[model samples]
Target chain A: MYPKSIKDLIEDFSKLPGVGEKTAERFVLFLATQKEKDGILSFSSHLKEMTDKIVKCERCHMLTEDTICDICKSKERDTETLMVVSDSKDVFVFEKMKTYHGQYHVLDGVIDFSKGISPEDLNIDSLLKKVASYKEVIIATNGTVEGELTAKYLKALLSDFNLSITRLAYGLPVGSDLKYADELTLNKAVENRQKY
Target chain B: MYPKSIKDLIEDFSKLPGVGEKTAERFVLFLATQKEKDGILSFSSHLKEMTDKIVKCERCHMLTEDTICDICKSKERDTETLMVVSDSKDVFVFEKMKTYHGQYHVLDGVIDFSKGISPEDLNIDSLLKKVASYKEVIIATNGTVEGELTAKYLKALLSDFNLSITRLAYGLPVGSDLKYADELTLNKAVENRQKY
Candidate 1:
């Protein structure tokens, strides 16, 4: 068994998205044993600093230090094109590509009835208010069932507006062998094959 | 790109063992966005608490809240038998089995030449001082190359003392099928087979 404070820290770490009790224990012990005397102290200070400074961007619902995110504030991005994503990390993924010049709107989470998340729980009111200004709305949620459902729901909501709503195309991932491709992915790839 | 404090936190998380930059980013984002407003603040406080409290046991070199660990302080333990381990975690593992009622001596680390970790860097000085009181010294380090090397080194050093030095038996792990066992494990199991 761990010391009281160590056990408490492990419990806190276990609350993170993917970390389990064993992983949390490993993390805590590594910090306690492996790091320098001031390592954990500095790490704790950094956590405090992040908690004090980071806030959700008012316009896009993305994590930012200021009221408006850098992406939302930038004038160079194509304001007419908006990419809707489930979480803020997706924004970074798109930005890393260096090709998407459009703005982003983080929904915070997708609609999952099983988890009791509904359309009203998402950051959609402001999205609906600003929908008329965008020429195209790209639903760029993940390829999961919840992502598909959210994309479909967003499409229906934005159908009344004079904007083209589109979902990301489904296909086999790049560099993946066809032999290992699943039936659903193969079906979609065949259905949406390019002329090339 | 992440904001200043968030980026700093991510870097700190990345320093943790087995955590990469992407996983660190996910951890920071999850802490910042998914958790309640005070979650990160509380987590930081807990880290500070752990740093302020936990200390290494004077005798065994295991992490504990007091000057001596519970195991070292306990009169119920078999002080004549000592278990020499590579890390403090190994002590906990042996304790959980409830079969080993011996005292423990944490070496803190194994003799890793690649990492420039020599026996001098470990807590072997105290071990050498106290090993004479024990009737048996069990070298319970891991099965890795470094662990075996450390065990051999300890055996040579402790050979001067009156105590009997022993190594843990190597064989297939419990609940593992023979077909699934690796060649090295199979070889070790065959070489060290027990009598029915």
Candidate 2:
């Protein structure tokens, strides 16, 4: 058997999805080899800070350090449009790109028929309440079946609203080779082409 | 950009060798969803504890919580023979299977020409010192060119001493289907067959 601390930490890390026992061992051993232990010790405090400080924003259901997320509180962002996403990771991805200038509404997860999930089970109520303030709601959920199903359901739910509703563009990615593009993506690229 | 704490923690976790940015995001999100946040928070402290607690055994060069590892300190294990391993991971593997009963000398790594590693870079000096007290030395390094080179070098180093030296058996692994076994392994299996 390994040292108690090594075994315990390996179990904790291995429980994370996608991390195997071998990877867990490597991580533990790596931490042990780090000469300046403070770097690793600080990681613990950060987890605690995230646990205690991060909260669900009441306005948009995004994780934040305050009652309302920074995006919802920002004046420079386009309050005229909102992006509807499935999780905070999606929000993080968009923020990393710094391309989108709109706020987001996290649905948490898409509806799953097998799992018996419905629109009411998600953050749909808050999204419905927040969509009233935006001129447009861009459905930015991923292109999976559940994501498509959730987008359709949201469209039906918000049909009577005065604002426009749009789904994310489906076509060839920005830098992908056209020859290697899948049939569905290639077809969508042709269908959605604009005037040159 | 995300919150400072979120971004910092993601960077730390992603810096681990095998963890990608996507996997790091999933790990962080999974920790955030834990019903009891202590599970993840404790992991950080455990890492610090490992850094402060674990040390190399002075006698055998194995990782231990004390100056002498349990194996080296044990009286029941064969004192006349010792197993030479590349790393603590190999020790853990033998322990997990309850197969090996001899003490271990951790070489840490082997000579690699491409990596510019030499015998001096490993724990060879300590191994040479320890091998003098044993009657036999078993080279248990992996079946790589570097491993064989190290074993040969160790054998030459211990030839002047009274101790006999041996290498681990190389043949087809037990329970492997002969049809799927590689040509080299099949050849070794036939070359090293024992009386049935």
Candidate 3:
């Protein structure tokens, strides 16, 4: 058995989302080890800094240190187009491609009834208020049932705002086998085929 | 892009084993979220405590706050029987069974040539000094090639001393299928068959 402080550290680490007890122990051991002194110091300092400084963007609900996130404040991005997603991470995923020049709105929660994530818990109000500035609102939520439900709800909510509501088309992935495609996705792909 | 402090936190989280960039982002975001305030405080405090307080046991090289570990100082354990291991985690794995009342010696590392962990880097001198007091030494290092090399080297190191050196038997795990057993393990199991 370890000392009280180490035991508490391991317990706290295990409480993190993905780390289990064994992994938590390993992390603690690494922290206490002689080689990891510098790493531990830097990590702790960064964690403190992040918790103290990071705040949510007022318009899009994305995590940021400033009142508004970079994308929302940037003049380079297309303010007339907006992409709505479930989590802040999705904003990063879309940004990684360097293709989507539009702004983003992080819903932060989806309509997962089982998990108690209702439409009311999300930042949908800010989205509705912000949607008026954009000509097009793209529902780039996950391809799950909750995402579909959230998109439908958003579409209905923003219907009277005179903005074009578009959902990402369901199709086989870029390099997938047609034989392995799910029936629903295959059907949707066929239904939404273009002239080309 | 995220703010400076949050970005630094994500980088630190990503440095942890089994945690990727996306998972690190999720962890940092979770930390910044309103719901995780209490956990963040406790986690930081515990981390600080662990880094500041925890020290290695002088006798067996196990991590602890005291000069000697609880197991080493305990009068109830069999001081004559020493269990030698490559890491302190192995001590815990054996302890979890509630058996093995013998004393332990943590080598802390093995002959990891790839990582440049040689015998000199280990606590071998302390083990030799302490092993003389014990009649039997059980090498309970990991079942890896490095562990075997360490065991062989230890045997040679301790051959001049009057003690019975033994290695843990290689066999199918207690609840494992014989059909799924690997070739080396099966061979060892067959070679070291025990009488009922």
Best by DockQ: 1
Task: Summarize candidate 3's per-residue lDDT along A5-73 as a digit string, tens digits.
Answer: 888988987877778999998877767775667667777777777777877889898878789888989
Global lDDT scores for all candidate models: 0.91, 0.84, 0.84
Candidates sorted by DockQ, descending order?
Answer: 1, 3, 2
The TM-score between candidate 2 and the true structure equals: 0.86
Q: Pick the winner on lDDT between candidates 1 and 3.
A: 1
Point to the candidate with the largest lDDT.
Answer: 1
A15 Cα displacement, candidate 1 (Å): 2.4
Runs with alpha carbons beyond 4 Å of true place in candidate 2: A172-196, B33-36, B112-117, B173-196
- Could you tell me the lDDT of residue A143 within candidate 1? 89
Model 1, CA-based lDDT: 0.91
Tell me how far the alpha carbon of residue A127 in candidate 2 is from the true structure, in angstroms, after superposition. 2.4
Question: Each candidate's TM vs. the true structure?
Answer: 0.89, 0.86, 0.93
DockQ, every prediction = 0.72, 0.56, 0.63
Model 2 lDDT per residue over B1-196, tens place: 6677676778789978878887787788766656687776787677667777888899887888989999999998988889999988788888888867888999888889899999999998887766778998999988899998988988888898998788899888888888998998889889999998
lDDT of 1 by residue, A1-196 (tens): 6788888999999997799998998998888885576878889999999888888899999889999999999999999999999999899888889999999999989999999999999999989998889999999998899999999899989999999888889999999999999999999999999998
